[model samples]
Target: NGASRFGRLRQTLAGVSEKMLTQTLRTLERDGLVRRTVYPEVPPHVEYELTALGQTLREPLKALTEWSVVHIEEVITARGEYDDRAERTR
Candidate 1:
C-alpha cells in the first residue's frame, strides 16, 4: 500500500516473473504513477510507492475489480457463445 520493496511486491503478486515485474515497475515510474527510491547501503535498497496521481486511481480500480468479480461468469458465458458462433462460421 505504501512504500514496499521489489521482493515484497513480487511476493504479493504471485506468478509474475522478475523481468515482467521490473518492466512494469519501470513503466509505471516512467508514467509518473509510481515513485522509485534508491538508498545507498551495503547492498543498495530500493522501494516503490504510488505517486499522488496513482493514489487517485484507487477508487476506480477498486470499482473495476468489484465489477469484474460480479460479471466474470457472464463474461465467460458470452465468450463461450462467441467462440461457438465463430466455429460455426468457420
Candidate 2:
C-alpha cells in the first residue's frame, strides 16, 4: 500500500524516536511533501503518504544516498586529515 500507518513507519525506520519521527512527519506535511490522514476511531489512527511532489524526490534522494555511501571513506579520510592539520597548528 502507498499509505502507511504511524506504527508501521516507526518499525520500518529503526532508531528514530517516536517524538522525532512525529516531528519529522509534521515538518514534511507542512512542507507539502507528505499528506497525513487521521481516522476517527476509538483511538485516533494516523497514516502518512508521500505527495506527488514528494514522490518526485525519491530518485534524487536515492542517488544522493548512494553517492554518500560511495564517498563515505573519502569523507572520513578528509576529516581526519583536517583534524590532524588543526592539531599540528595548535
Instruction: Please report, as a residue range, the 10-residue window in candidate 2 with the lowest summed lDDT.
Output: 1-10
Candidate 1 runs further than 4 Å off: none
Q: Listing every candidate in turn, what is its Cα RMSD in Å to the true structure after a full C-alpha superposition?
A: 1.3, 1.8
**Model 2: pairs clashing at backbone N, Cα or C within 3 Å:** none
The Cα error of candidate 2 at residue 73, in Å, is 1.1
lDDT of 1 by residue, 1-90 (tens): 899999999999999999999999999999999999999997989999999999999999999999999999999999999999999999
Residue 63 error, candidate 1, Å: 0.5
Candidate 2 Cα misplacement greater than 4 A, ranges: 86-90
Cα lDDT, model 1, residue 32: 95
Q: Which pairs clash in model 1?
A: none
Write the residue-wise lDDT of candidate 2 on 33-89 in tens digits.
Answer: 999999999799888999999999999999999999999999999999999999999
Candidate 2 global Cα RMSD? 1.8
Give the TM-scores of the predictions, in the order they appear. 0.89, 0.84
